[model samples]
Target: MADKEMRAVYAETLTELASKDDRIVVLEADLMRATGTGPFKEKYPDRAVNVGVAEANMLSIAGGMSTEGYIPFAATFGCFATRRAFDQFFLSCAYAGLNVKLVGTDPGVSAAFNGGTHMPFEDLGLVRMVPGIDIVEPSDPVSLKALVQQIAARPNSAYIRLHRKALSPLYPETATFEVGKAKVLRSGTGVTLAALGGLMVHNAVTAAELLAADGISAEVIDVLSLKPLDAETILASARKTGLVISIENHQAHNGLGSAVAELFAEAADRPARLVRMGIQDQFGEVGTEAWLLEKFGLRAEDIAAAVKKALKG
Candidate 1:
Protein backbone atom coordinates (compact mmCIF):
# COMPACT_ATOMS: atom_id res chain seq x y z
CA MET A 1 0.00 0.00 0.00
CA ALA A 2 2.80 2.35 0.93
CA ASP A 3 4.80 1.47 -2.18
CA LYS A 4 1.94 2.43 -4.55
CA GLU A 5 -0.04 5.34 -3.12
CA MET A 6 -2.17 7.64 -5.32
CA ARG A 7 -2.57 10.35 -2.66
CA ALA A 8 1.19 10.81 -2.39
CA VAL A 9 1.44 10.83 -6.18
CA TYR A 10 -1.36 13.40 -6.44
CA ALA A 11 0.29 15.67 -3.85
CA GLU A 12 3.71 15.39 -5.49
CA THR A 13 2.37 15.98 -9.00
CA LEU A 14 0.22 18.90 -7.84
CA THR A 15 3.22 20.45 -6.14
CA GLU A 16 5.24 20.11 -9.34
CA LEU A 17 2.43 21.63 -11.40
CA ALA A 18 2.08 24.52 -8.96
CA SER A 19 5.81 25.13 -9.18
CA LYS A 20 5.72 25.23 -12.96
CA ASP A 21 2.60 27.39 -13.31
CA ASP A 22 2.69 30.80 -11.68
CA ARG A 23 -1.05 31.33 -12.24
CA ILE A 24 -1.95 28.16 -10.29
CA VAL A 25 -3.61 28.86 -6.95
CA VAL A 26 -5.01 26.26 -4.50
CA LEU A 27 -7.98 26.77 -2.16
CA GLU A 28 -8.92 24.22 0.48
CA ALA A 29 -11.88 23.96 2.85
CA ASP A 30 -9.90 22.95 5.91
CA LEU A 31 -8.80 19.75 4.11
CA MET A 32 -5.24 20.54 3.13
CA ARG A 33 -3.95 17.94 5.60
CA ALA A 34 -6.54 15.30 4.66
CA THR A 35 -6.14 15.75 0.90
CA GLY A 36 -2.30 15.89 1.10
CA THR A 37 -2.05 19.54 0.03
CA GLY A 38 0.05 20.53 3.06
CA PRO A 39 3.29 20.42 1.08
CA PHE A 40 1.85 22.84 -1.49
CA LYS A 41 0.84 25.27 1.27
CA GLU A 42 4.24 25.01 2.93
CA LYS A 43 6.07 25.60 -0.34
CA TYR A 44 3.71 28.28 -1.67
CA PRO A 45 2.02 29.85 1.31
CA ASP A 46 0.88 32.90 -0.62
CA ARG A 47 -0.68 30.77 -3.38
CA ALA A 48 -2.52 28.35 -1.11
CA VAL A 49 -5.42 29.64 0.96
CA ASN A 50 -7.21 27.63 3.66
CA VAL A 51 -10.84 28.85 3.61
CA GLY A 52 -11.77 27.28 6.91
CA VAL A 53 -14.90 24.99 6.80
CA ALA A 54 -16.96 26.94 4.29
CA GLU A 55 -17.21 24.95 1.10
CA ALA A 56 -19.51 27.40 -0.70
CA ASN A 57 -17.32 30.36 0.13
CA MET A 58 -14.26 28.46 -1.06
CA LEU A 59 -15.93 27.75 -4.43
CA SER A 60 -17.03 31.36 -4.86
CA ILE A 61 -13.57 32.63 -3.97
CA ALA A 62 -12.01 30.17 -6.42
CA GLY A 63 -14.44 31.33 -9.09
CA GLY A 64 -13.57 34.95 -8.38
CA MET A 65 -9.88 34.15 -8.63
CA SER A 66 -10.41 32.32 -11.92
CA THR A 67 -12.21 35.36 -13.28
CA GLU A 68 -9.05 37.37 -12.63
CA GLY A 69 -6.91 35.13 -14.87
CA TYR A 70 -5.95 32.71 -12.12
CA ILE A 71 -6.31 28.93 -12.20
CA PRO A 72 -7.68 27.89 -8.81
CA PHE A 73 -7.75 24.23 -7.72
CA ALA A 74 -10.32 24.06 -4.93
CA ALA A 75 -9.86 20.99 -2.71
CA THR A 76 -12.33 19.44 -0.25
CA PHE A 77 -14.08 16.21 0.67
CA GLY A 78 -16.35 14.80 -2.07
CA CYS A 79 -19.51 15.07 0.02
CA PHE A 80 -18.78 18.68 0.88
CA ALA A 81 -17.91 19.68 -2.68
CA THR A 82 -20.93 18.12 -4.38
CA ARG A 83 -23.64 18.15 -1.72
CA ARG A 84 -22.70 21.22 0.31
CA ALA A 85 -21.67 23.76 -2.31
CA PHE A 86 -23.32 22.47 -5.48
CA ASP A 87 -25.21 25.73 -6.10
CA GLN A 88 -22.08 27.77 -5.75
CA PHE A 89 -20.24 25.43 -8.06
CA PHE A 90 -23.04 25.64 -10.61
CA LEU A 91 -23.43 29.41 -10.52
CA SER A 92 -19.83 30.49 -10.06
CA CYS A 93 -17.89 27.84 -11.97
CA ALA A 94 -19.99 25.77 -14.37
CA TYR A 95 -22.39 28.51 -15.44
CA ALA A 96 -19.55 30.97 -15.97
CA GLY A 97 -17.30 28.29 -17.45
CA LEU A 98 -14.47 29.39 -15.21
CA ASN A 99 -11.11 27.65 -15.25
CA VAL A 100 -11.44 26.20 -11.78
CA LYS A 101 -10.39 22.67 -10.87
CA LEU A 102 -12.65 21.15 -8.21
CA VAL A 103 -10.72 18.43 -6.37
CA GLY A 104 -12.98 16.12 -4.36
CA THR A 105 -11.10 13.71 -2.13
CA ASP A 106 -12.41 10.69 -0.18
CA PRO A 107 -15.02 9.70 -2.74
CA GLY A 108 -17.34 6.70 -2.32
CA VAL A 109 -16.48 4.06 0.27
CA SER A 110 -12.97 5.45 0.31
CA ALA A 111 -14.14 7.53 3.25
CA ALA A 112 -14.28 4.19 5.14
CA PHE A 113 -13.90 4.96 8.84
CA ASN A 114 -15.17 8.48 8.33
CA GLY A 115 -18.75 7.08 8.27
CA GLY A 116 -21.65 7.43 5.82
CA THR A 117 -21.82 11.20 6.14
CA HIS A 118 -18.37 11.57 4.66
CA MET A 119 -18.77 8.99 1.87
CA PRO A 120 -19.70 10.51 -1.52
CA PHE A 121 -21.18 7.66 -3.53
CA GLU A 122 -23.10 9.96 -5.89
CA ASP A 123 -20.69 12.85 -6.38
CA LEU A 124 -19.66 11.73 -9.84
CA GLY A 125 -23.27 11.44 -10.97
CA LEU A 126 -24.16 14.81 -9.49
CA VAL A 127 -21.18 16.56 -10.99
CA ARG A 128 -21.71 14.93 -14.36
CA MET A 129 -25.16 16.51 -14.57
CA VAL A 130 -23.67 19.98 -14.37
CA PRO A 131 -23.53 21.59 -17.80
CA GLY A 132 -20.10 22.38 -19.24
CA ILE A 133 -18.41 20.56 -16.36
CA ASP A 134 -15.80 17.89 -17.07
CA ILE A 135 -15.70 14.92 -14.69
CA VAL A 136 -12.70 12.58 -14.18
CA GLU A 137 -11.57 9.80 -11.84
CA PRO A 138 -8.07 8.51 -12.46
CA SER A 139 -7.37 4.81 -11.98
CA ASP A 140 -3.83 4.93 -10.61
CA PRO A 141 -0.88 7.09 -9.66
CA VAL A 142 0.50 7.37 -13.18
CA SER A 143 -2.86 8.34 -14.62
CA LEU A 144 -3.49 10.73 -11.73
CA LYS A 145 -0.26 12.59 -12.37
CA ALA A 146 -0.96 12.80 -16.08
CA LEU A 147 -4.49 14.06 -15.41
CA VAL A 148 -3.24 16.69 -12.95
CA GLN A 149 -0.76 17.96 -15.53
CA GLN A 150 -3.40 18.03 -18.25
CA ILE A 151 -5.97 19.78 -16.05
CA ALA A 152 -3.40 22.34 -14.98
CA ALA A 153 -2.62 23.17 -18.58
CA ARG A 154 -6.21 23.05 -19.90
CA PRO A 155 -8.52 25.99 -19.27
CA ASN A 156 -11.87 24.46 -18.37
CA SER A 157 -14.24 23.84 -15.48
CA ALA A 158 -13.54 20.31 -14.24
CA TYR A 159 -14.04 18.12 -11.19
CA ILE A 160 -11.59 15.42 -10.11
CA ARG A 161 -12.59 12.82 -7.52
CA LEU A 162 -9.90 10.90 -5.59
CA HIS A 163 -9.95 8.13 -3.04
CA ARG A 164 -8.77 8.88 0.48
CA LYS A 165 -6.55 5.78 0.65
CA ALA A 166 -3.67 5.07 -1.68
CA LEU A 167 -4.03 2.91 -4.80
CA SER A 168 -1.71 0.55 -6.66
CA PRO A 169 -0.08 1.61 -9.91
CA LEU A 170 -1.92 0.08 -12.90
CA TYR A 171 -0.46 1.96 -15.87
CA PRO A 172 3.07 2.59 -17.07
CA GLU A 173 4.78 5.96 -16.50
CA THR A 174 4.92 6.57 -20.26
CA ALA A 175 1.24 5.96 -20.82
CA THR A 176 -0.46 8.90 -22.53
CA PHE A 177 -3.99 9.96 -21.57
CA GLU A 178 -6.61 11.60 -23.79
CA VAL A 179 -9.28 13.85 -22.34
CA GLY A 180 -12.26 11.89 -23.74
CA LYS A 181 -10.75 8.53 -24.61
CA ALA A 182 -10.48 5.24 -22.69
CA LYS A 183 -7.33 3.11 -22.49
CA VAL A 184 -7.45 -0.56 -23.41
CA LEU A 185 -5.22 -2.48 -21.02
CA ARG A 186 -5.95 -6.04 -22.25
CA SER A 187 -7.27 -7.46 -25.53
CA GLY A 188 -9.63 -10.37 -25.43
CA THR A 189 -12.49 -11.91 -27.44
CA GLY A 190 -14.59 -13.30 -24.65
CA VAL A 191 -15.60 -10.46 -22.29
CA THR A 192 -15.04 -6.71 -21.93
CA LEU A 193 -14.59 -5.10 -18.48
CA ALA A 194 -14.87 -1.30 -18.49
CA ALA A 195 -13.88 0.29 -15.19
CA LEU A 196 -12.95 3.63 -13.65
CA GLY A 197 -10.94 4.72 -10.59
CA GLY A 198 -9.17 2.11 -8.39
CA LEU A 199 -11.68 -0.59 -9.35
CA MET A 200 -10.31 -0.69 -12.90
CA VAL A 201 -7.06 -2.43 -11.90
CA HIS A 202 -8.84 -4.69 -9.46
CA ASN A 203 -11.20 -5.94 -12.19
CA ALA A 204 -8.26 -6.44 -14.53
CA VAL A 205 -6.60 -8.74 -12.02
CA THR A 206 -9.84 -10.63 -11.56
CA ALA A 207 -10.21 -10.93 -15.33
CA ALA A 208 -6.69 -12.36 -15.60
CA GLU A 209 -7.32 -14.99 -12.93
CA LEU A 210 -10.70 -15.84 -14.44
CA LEU A 211 -9.15 -16.23 -17.87
CA ALA A 212 -6.63 -18.77 -16.61
CA ALA A 213 -9.34 -20.86 -14.99
CA ASP A 214 -12.12 -20.72 -17.61
CA GLY A 215 -10.20 -20.02 -20.83
CA ILE A 216 -12.42 -16.94 -21.28
CA SER A 217 -10.16 -13.97 -21.91
CA ALA A 218 -11.46 -10.59 -20.77
CA GLU A 219 -10.68 -7.18 -22.29
CA VAL A 220 -9.96 -4.47 -19.69
CA ILE A 221 -10.55 -0.77 -20.47
CA ASP A 222 -9.49 2.00 -18.09
CA VAL A 223 -12.05 4.81 -18.33
CA LEU A 224 -10.21 7.71 -16.73
CA SER A 225 -12.54 10.37 -18.05
CA LEU A 226 -16.19 9.89 -17.09
CA LYS A 227 -17.95 12.93 -18.60
CA PRO A 228 -16.82 12.77 -22.22
CA LEU A 229 -16.98 9.00 -22.49
CA ASP A 230 -15.02 7.33 -25.28
CA ALA A 231 -17.94 5.90 -27.20
CA GLU A 232 -15.72 4.50 -29.93
CA THR A 233 -13.58 2.49 -27.53
CA ILE A 234 -16.59 1.22 -25.60
CA LEU A 235 -18.52 0.14 -28.71
CA ALA A 236 -15.48 -1.51 -30.24
CA SER A 237 -14.70 -3.43 -27.08
CA ALA A 238 -18.30 -4.59 -26.71
CA ARG A 239 -18.42 -5.70 -30.33
CA LYS A 240 -15.15 -7.61 -29.94
CA THR A 241 -15.77 -9.28 -26.55
CA GLY A 242 -19.54 -10.00 -26.87
CA LEU A 243 -19.88 -9.57 -23.09
CA VAL A 244 -19.61 -6.30 -21.14
CA ILE A 245 -19.15 -5.64 -17.43
CA SER A 246 -18.84 -2.15 -15.93
CA ILE A 247 -17.14 -1.72 -12.56
CA GLU A 248 -16.97 1.40 -10.38
CA ASN A 249 -17.04 2.65 -6.77
CA HIS A 250 -20.10 4.80 -7.39
CA GLN A 251 -23.73 3.81 -7.83
CA ALA A 252 -24.97 1.86 -10.85
CA HIS A 253 -27.59 4.46 -11.73
CA ASN A 254 -26.47 7.70 -13.47
CA GLY A 255 -22.77 6.81 -13.17
CA LEU A 256 -20.44 4.81 -15.43
CA GLY A 257 -22.93 1.98 -15.78
CA SER A 258 -25.75 4.24 -16.92
CA ALA A 259 -23.46 6.15 -19.26
CA VAL A 260 -22.29 2.97 -20.99
CA ALA A 261 -25.83 1.67 -21.24
CA GLU A 262 -27.06 4.90 -22.80
CA LEU A 263 -24.28 4.77 -25.38
CA PHE A 264 -24.99 1.16 -26.29
CA ALA A 265 -28.72 1.83 -26.53
CA GLU A 266 -28.27 4.80 -28.86
CA ALA A 267 -25.96 2.81 -31.13
CA ALA A 268 -28.84 0.31 -31.54
CA ASP A 269 -26.52 -2.64 -31.75
CA ARG A 270 -26.48 -5.94 -29.97
CA PRO A 271 -23.30 -4.90 -28.18
CA ALA A 272 -23.01 -7.65 -25.56
CA ARG A 273 -24.51 -9.18 -22.46
CA LEU A 274 -24.00 -6.05 -20.36
CA VAL A 275 -23.72 -6.18 -16.56
CA ARG A 276 -23.24 -3.34 -14.10
CA MET A 277 -21.28 -3.97 -10.88
CA GLY A 278 -21.38 -1.21 -8.25
CA ILE A 279 -23.25 0.06 -5.17
CA GLN A 280 -26.68 -0.78 -6.66
CA ASP A 281 -28.26 2.61 -5.80
CA GLN A 282 -27.74 2.21 -2.05
CA PHE A 283 -26.16 4.59 0.45
CA GLY A 284 -22.82 3.65 1.98
CA GLU A 285 -22.58 2.53 5.61
CA VAL A 286 -19.89 3.11 8.23
CA GLY A 287 -17.05 0.55 8.00
CA THR A 288 -13.53 -0.07 6.82
CA GLU A 289 -12.75 0.42 3.14
CA ALA A 290 -12.29 -3.29 2.54
CA TRP A 291 -15.45 -4.16 4.41
CA LEU A 292 -17.53 -1.55 2.60
CA LEU A 293 -16.28 -2.72 -0.78
CA GLU A 294 -17.17 -6.30 0.02
CA LYS A 295 -20.53 -5.33 1.44
CA PHE A 296 -21.40 -3.40 -1.72
CA GLY A 297 -20.14 -6.25 -3.95
CA LEU A 298 -17.27 -4.24 -5.43
CA ARG A 299 -14.53 -6.79 -4.72
CA ALA A 300 -12.62 -8.71 -7.39
CA GLU A 301 -14.58 -11.84 -6.61
CA ASP A 302 -17.83 -9.96 -7.13
CA ILE A 303 -16.60 -8.56 -10.41
CA ALA A 304 -15.50 -11.98 -11.59
CA ALA A 305 -18.91 -13.36 -10.72
CA ALA A 306 -20.63 -10.62 -12.72
CA VAL A 307 -18.42 -11.32 -15.71
CA LYS A 308 -19.18 -15.03 -15.51
CA LYS A 309 -22.88 -14.35 -15.25
CA ALA A 310 -22.77 -11.98 -18.20
CA LEU A 311 -20.85 -14.51 -20.25
CA LYS A 312 -23.26 -17.29 -19.50
CA GLY A 313 -26.43 -15.26 -20.02
Candidate 2:
Protein backbone atom coordinates (compact mmCIF):
# COMPACT_ATOMS: atom_id res chain seq x y z
CA MET A 1 0.00 0.00 0.00
CA ALA A 2 1.14 3.52 -0.72
CA ASP A 3 1.46 6.11 2.05
CA LYS A 4 2.79 9.27 0.44
CA GLU A 5 0.47 12.08 -0.66
CA MET A 6 1.39 13.42 -4.11
CA ARG A 7 0.74 17.02 -3.11
CA ALA A 8 3.25 16.78 -0.25
CA VAL A 9 5.85 15.37 -2.61
CA TYR A 10 5.04 18.10 -5.12
CA ALA A 11 5.46 20.83 -2.53
CA GLU A 12 8.71 19.32 -1.31
CA THR A 13 10.09 19.06 -4.85
CA LEU A 14 9.31 22.71 -5.63
CA THR A 15 10.83 23.88 -2.35
CA GLU A 16 13.98 21.85 -2.92
CA LEU A 17 14.30 23.12 -6.50
CA ALA A 18 13.74 26.70 -5.34
CA SER A 19 16.60 26.38 -2.85
CA LYS A 20 19.08 25.89 -5.70
CA ASP A 21 17.39 27.99 -8.36
CA ASP A 22 16.27 31.37 -7.04
CA ARG A 23 14.23 31.86 -10.24
CA ILE A 24 11.64 29.26 -9.21
CA VAL A 25 8.19 30.65 -8.31
CA VAL A 26 5.08 28.86 -7.08
CA LEU A 27 1.72 30.35 -8.20
CA GLU A 28 -1.63 29.11 -7.00
CA ALA A 29 -5.24 30.18 -7.62
CA ASP A 30 -6.19 30.28 -3.95
CA LEU A 31 -5.42 26.56 -3.83
CA MET A 32 -2.14 26.45 -1.95
CA ARG A 33 -3.88 24.90 1.04
CA ALA A 34 -5.86 22.43 -1.02
CA THR A 35 -2.87 21.44 -3.11
CA GLY A 36 -0.54 21.18 -0.10
CA THR A 37 2.01 23.95 -0.72
CA GLY A 38 1.97 25.40 2.77
CA PRO A 39 5.52 24.37 3.54
CA PHE A 40 6.86 25.99 0.43
CA LYS A 41 4.97 29.21 1.13
CA GLU A 42 6.19 29.21 4.73
CA LYS A 43 9.79 28.78 3.65
CA TYR A 44 9.72 31.16 0.70
CA PRO A 45 6.95 33.73 1.09
CA ASP A 46 8.24 36.10 -1.55
CA ARG A 47 8.37 33.38 -4.22
CA ALA A 48 4.86 32.11 -3.50
CA VAL A 49 1.95 34.08 -5.00
CA ASN A 50 -1.75 33.41 -4.47
CA VAL A 51 -4.08 34.79 -7.16
CA GLY A 52 -7.25 34.24 -5.13
CA VAL A 53 -9.46 31.88 -7.20
CA ALA A 54 -8.68 33.70 -10.43
CA GLU A 55 -7.20 30.83 -12.43
CA ALA A 56 -6.99 32.75 -15.69
CA ASN A 57 -5.18 35.64 -14.09
CA MET A 58 -2.88 33.17 -12.37
CA LEU A 59 -1.68 31.79 -15.69
CA SER A 60 -1.38 35.23 -17.19
CA ILE A 61 0.67 36.30 -14.19
CA ALA A 62 2.79 33.21 -14.57
CA GLY A 63 3.22 33.97 -18.27
CA GLY A 64 4.47 37.48 -17.55
CA MET A 65 6.76 36.29 -14.78
CA SER A 66 8.32 33.74 -17.08
CA THR A 67 9.44 36.62 -19.32
CA GLU A 68 11.52 37.86 -16.37
CA GLY A 69 13.21 34.40 -16.38
CA TYR A 70 11.24 33.05 -13.44
CA ILE A 71 10.16 29.42 -13.70
CA PRO A 72 6.51 29.59 -12.65
CA PHE A 73 4.50 26.58 -11.51
CA ALA A 74 0.88 27.69 -11.72
CA ALA A 75 -1.57 25.29 -10.09
CA THR A 76 -5.33 24.89 -9.51
CA PHE A 77 -8.06 22.28 -9.83
CA GLY A 78 -7.77 20.39 -13.09
CA CYS A 79 -11.04 21.69 -14.49
CA PHE A 80 -10.21 25.39 -14.06
CA ALA A 81 -6.52 25.00 -14.65
CA THR A 82 -7.06 23.65 -18.17
CA ARG A 83 -10.54 24.70 -19.33
CA ARG A 84 -10.88 28.13 -17.70
CA ALA A 85 -7.29 29.31 -17.96
CA PHE A 86 -6.43 27.55 -21.22
CA ASP A 87 -6.24 30.72 -23.30
CA GLN A 88 -3.69 32.31 -21.00
CA PHE A 89 -1.68 29.09 -20.92
CA PHE A 90 -1.79 28.62 -24.69
CA LEU A 91 -1.34 32.23 -25.72
CA SER A 92 0.52 34.00 -22.91
CA CYS A 93 2.80 31.07 -22.15
CA ALA A 94 3.06 28.53 -24.98
CA TYR A 95 2.44 30.84 -27.90
CA ALA A 96 4.85 33.38 -26.52
CA GLY A 97 7.41 30.59 -26.03
CA LEU A 98 7.79 31.41 -22.37
CA ASN A 99 8.62 28.65 -19.91
CA VAL A 100 5.87 27.87 -17.40
CA LYS A 101 4.89 24.60 -15.73
CA LEU A 102 1.13 24.36 -15.30
CA VAL A 103 -0.05 21.89 -12.68
CA GLY A 104 -3.65 20.55 -12.60
CA THR A 105 -4.41 18.67 -9.41
CA ASP A 106 -6.98 15.90 -8.81
CA PRO A 107 -7.36 14.97 -12.44
CA GLY A 108 -10.24 12.71 -13.57
CA VAL A 109 -12.20 10.68 -10.99
CA SER A 110 -9.65 11.58 -8.37
CA ALA A 111 -11.78 14.66 -7.73
CA ALA A 112 -14.04 12.26 -5.75
CA PHE A 113 -16.37 14.19 -3.42
CA ASN A 114 -15.58 17.43 -5.23
CA GLY A 115 -18.03 16.07 -7.87
CA GLY A 116 -18.54 16.79 -11.56
CA THR A 117 -18.03 20.55 -11.61
CA HIS A 118 -14.53 20.36 -10.17
CA MET A 119 -13.44 17.16 -11.90
CA PRO A 120 -11.39 17.14 -15.09
CA PHE A 121 -11.73 14.21 -17.50
CA GLU A 122 -10.39 16.22 -20.41
CA ASP A 123 -7.56 18.34 -19.08
CA LEU A 124 -4.80 16.48 -20.89
CA GLY A 125 -6.76 16.40 -24.15
CA LEU A 126 -7.36 20.14 -23.94
CA VAL A 127 -3.67 20.77 -23.32
CA ARG A 128 -2.83 18.37 -26.14
CA MET A 129 -4.41 20.76 -28.61
CA VAL A 130 -1.81 23.39 -27.81
CA PRO A 131 1.10 23.16 -30.22
CA GLY A 132 4.65 22.80 -28.84
CA ILE A 133 3.40 22.18 -25.30
CA ASP A 134 4.46 19.08 -23.38
CA ILE A 135 1.83 16.99 -21.51
CA VAL A 136 2.74 14.65 -18.62
CA GLU A 137 1.06 12.70 -15.79
CA PRO A 138 3.07 11.20 -12.94
CA SER A 139 2.02 7.81 -11.55
CA ASP A 140 3.49 8.01 -8.05
CA PRO A 141 5.27 10.23 -5.57
CA VAL A 142 8.65 9.39 -7.08
CA SER A 143 7.60 10.11 -10.65
CA LEU A 144 5.76 13.26 -9.61
CA LYS A 145 8.88 14.56 -7.87
CA ALA A 146 11.13 13.61 -10.76
CA LEU A 147 8.90 14.91 -13.56
CA VAL A 148 8.31 18.21 -11.78
CA GLN A 149 12.07 18.73 -11.73
CA GLN A 150 12.42 17.52 -15.33
CA ILE A 151 9.68 19.84 -16.63
CA ALA A 152 11.19 22.73 -14.71
CA ALA A 153 14.50 22.07 -16.40
CA ARG A 154 12.95 22.15 -19.88
CA PRO A 155 12.24 25.22 -22.01
CA ASN A 156 8.78 24.30 -23.34
CA SER A 157 5.52 25.17 -21.60
CA ALA A 158 4.09 21.99 -20.02
CA TYR A 159 0.90 20.69 -18.42
CA ILE A 160 1.14 18.25 -15.52
CA ARG A 161 -1.97 16.19 -14.62
CA LEU A 162 -1.43 15.42 -10.95
CA HIS A 163 -3.26 13.11 -8.58
CA ARG A 164 -3.06 15.03 -5.31
CA LYS A 165 -4.07 12.26 -2.92
CA ALA A 166 -2.10 9.30 -1.59
CA LEU A 167 -0.80 6.73 -4.02
CA SER A 168 1.35 3.66 -3.37
CA PRO A 169 4.99 4.06 -4.30
CA LEU A 170 5.66 2.29 -7.59
CA TYR A 171 9.23 3.35 -8.26
CA PRO A 172 12.23 3.30 -5.97
CA GLU A 173 13.84 6.53 -4.78
CA THR A 174 16.80 5.90 -7.10
CA ALA A 175 14.56 5.35 -10.13
CA THR A 176 15.49 7.44 -13.12
CA PHE A 177 13.05 8.80 -15.73
CA GLU A 178 13.12 10.57 -19.07
CA VAL A 179 10.64 13.30 -19.91
CA GLY A 180 9.25 11.80 -23.12
CA LYS A 181 9.61 8.11 -22.39
CA ALA A 182 7.36 5.27 -21.17
CA LYS A 183 8.29 2.90 -18.35
CA VAL A 184 7.58 -0.79 -18.77
CA LEU A 185 6.41 -2.06 -15.40
CA ARG A 186 5.85 -5.66 -16.46
CA SER A 187 6.92 -7.82 -19.40
CA GLY A 188 4.65 -10.45 -20.88
CA THR A 189 3.72 -12.21 -24.11
CA GLY A 190 -0.07 -12.20 -24.19
CA VAL A 191 -1.49 -8.64 -24.11
CA THR A 192 -0.33 -5.11 -23.41
CA LEU A 193 -1.81 -2.65 -20.92
CA ALA A 194 -0.49 0.86 -21.47
CA ALA A 195 -1.79 3.25 -18.86
CA LEU A 196 -1.33 6.85 -17.71
CA GLY A 197 -1.52 8.51 -14.29
CA GLY A 198 -1.48 6.92 -10.85
CA LEU A 199 -4.92 5.31 -10.77
CA MET A 200 -5.00 3.55 -14.13
CA VAL A 201 -1.38 2.47 -14.07
CA HIS A 202 -1.80 0.68 -10.74
CA ASN A 203 -5.04 -0.92 -11.86
CA ALA A 204 -3.34 -2.11 -15.04
CA VAL A 205 -0.65 -3.81 -12.95
CA THR A 206 -3.27 -5.57 -10.84
CA ALA A 207 -5.13 -6.64 -13.98
CA ALA A 208 -1.91 -8.09 -15.31
CA GLU A 209 -1.53 -10.18 -12.15
CA LEU A 210 -5.13 -11.39 -12.48
CA LEU A 211 -4.45 -12.40 -16.09
CA ALA A 212 -1.42 -14.37 -14.97
CA ALA A 213 -3.66 -16.69 -12.99
CA ASP A 214 -5.53 -17.59 -16.16
CA GLY A 215 -2.30 -18.44 -17.99
CA ILE A 216 -2.37 -15.15 -19.93
CA SER A 217 0.57 -12.79 -19.97
CA ALA A 218 -0.06 -9.06 -19.84
CA GLU A 219 2.55 -6.35 -20.19
CA VAL A 220 2.04 -3.13 -18.29
CA ILE A 221 3.48 0.21 -19.44
CA ASP A 222 3.35 3.39 -17.43
CA VAL A 223 2.77 6.18 -19.93
CA LEU A 224 4.46 9.01 -18.06
CA SER A 225 4.45 11.42 -20.99
CA LEU A 226 1.23 12.05 -22.92
CA LYS A 227 2.22 14.52 -25.65
CA PRO A 228 5.41 12.82 -26.80
CA LEU A 229 3.56 9.46 -26.56
CA ASP A 230 6.79 7.35 -26.34
CA ALA A 231 5.87 5.74 -29.65
CA GLU A 232 8.79 3.32 -29.76
CA THR A 233 8.16 1.77 -26.34
CA ILE A 234 4.38 1.40 -26.91
CA LEU A 235 4.84 0.07 -30.46
CA ALA A 236 7.36 -2.47 -29.19
CA SER A 237 4.91 -3.75 -26.58
CA ALA A 238 2.16 -3.91 -29.22
CA ARG A 239 4.37 -5.99 -31.45
CA LYS A 240 5.25 -8.31 -28.59
CA THR A 241 1.67 -8.87 -27.41
CA GLY A 242 -0.35 -8.24 -30.59
CA LEU A 243 -3.03 -6.50 -28.46
CA VAL A 244 -2.89 -3.20 -26.62
CA ILE A 245 -5.41 -1.84 -24.15
CA SER A 246 -4.90 1.80 -23.19
CA ILE A 247 -6.23 2.63 -19.73
CA GLU A 248 -6.57 6.11 -18.27
CA ASN A 249 -8.47 8.14 -15.68
CA HIS A 250 -9.59 10.59 -18.35
CA GLN A 251 -12.04 10.51 -21.26
CA ALA A 252 -11.62 7.72 -23.80
CA HIS A 253 -11.16 10.20 -26.61
CA ASN A 254 -7.93 12.14 -27.19
CA GLY A 255 -6.24 10.90 -24.03
CA LEU A 256 -4.10 7.78 -23.62
CA GLY A 257 -6.37 5.70 -25.82
CA SER A 258 -6.33 8.12 -28.71
CA ALA A 259 -2.56 8.48 -28.41
CA VAL A 260 -2.08 4.71 -28.67
CA ALA A 261 -4.59 4.47 -31.53
CA GLU A 262 -2.70 7.10 -33.47
CA LEU A 263 0.50 5.14 -32.99
CA PHE A 264 -0.98 1.95 -34.49
CA ALA A 265 -2.81 3.93 -37.16
CA GLU A 266 0.38 5.44 -38.48
CA ALA A 267 2.76 2.55 -37.95
CA ALA A 268 4.39 1.19 -41.11
CA ASP A 269 3.33 -2.30 -40.03
CA ARG A 270 0.77 -2.03 -37.28
CA PRO A 271 1.03 -5.08 -35.03
CA ALA A 272 -1.82 -4.85 -32.54
CA ARG A 273 -5.54 -4.56 -31.91
CA LEU A 274 -6.43 -1.64 -29.65
CA VAL A 275 -9.11 -1.18 -26.97
CA ARG A 276 -9.62 2.10 -25.16
CA MET A 277 -10.88 1.85 -21.57
CA GLY A 278 -12.00 4.95 -19.71
CA ILE A 279 -15.00 7.23 -19.10
CA GLN A 280 -16.90 6.72 -22.34
CA ASP A 281 -19.13 9.82 -22.50
CA GLN A 282 -20.52 11.16 -19.26
CA PHE A 283 -19.96 13.78 -16.58
CA GLY A 284 -18.49 12.68 -13.28
CA GLU A 285 -20.77 12.58 -10.24
CA VAL A 286 -20.21 12.87 -6.50
CA GLY A 287 -18.79 9.57 -5.24
CA THR A 288 -15.79 8.06 -3.57
CA GLU A 289 -12.87 7.11 -5.82
CA ALA A 290 -13.65 3.39 -5.38
CA TRP A 291 -17.37 3.86 -6.14
CA LEU A 292 -16.59 6.04 -9.15
CA LEU A 293 -14.16 3.43 -10.40
CA GLU A 294 -16.90 0.79 -10.41
CA LYS A 295 -19.49 3.26 -11.75
CA PHE A 296 -17.31 4.06 -14.73
CA GLY A 297 -16.11 0.46 -15.19
CA LEU A 298 -12.49 1.44 -14.48
CA ARG A 299 -11.82 -1.10 -11.78
CA ALA A 300 -9.08 -3.71 -12.03
CA GLU A 301 -11.69 -6.46 -12.53
CA ASP A 302 -13.18 -4.40 -15.33
CA ILE A 303 -9.80 -4.19 -17.05
CA ALA A 304 -9.14 -7.91 -16.60
CA ALA A 305 -12.57 -8.80 -17.96
CA ALA A 306 -12.10 -6.47 -20.89
CA VAL A 307 -8.87 -8.24 -21.74
CA LYS A 308 -10.46 -11.67 -21.43
CA LYS A 309 -13.33 -10.64 -23.68
CA ALA A 310 -10.98 -9.24 -26.27
CA LEU A 311 -8.89 -12.39 -26.21
CA LYS A 312 -11.97 -14.55 -26.74
CA GLY A 313 -12.92 -12.70 -29.91
Give the residue spans of candidate 1 off by over 4 A: none
TM-score of each: 0.96, 0.99
lDDT of each: 0.84, 0.93
Model 2 regions lying over 4 Å from their true place:
none
- Tens-digit lDDT string for candidate 2 (229-260): 89989999999999999999999998889888
Q: Candidate 2, after superposition: displacement of residue 185 in Å?
A: 0.3
Which numbered prediction scores highest in TM-score against the true structure?
2
Error of 1 at 214 (Å): 1.9
The lDDT, on a scale of 0 to 1, for candidate 2 is 0.93
- How many clashes in candidate 2? 1
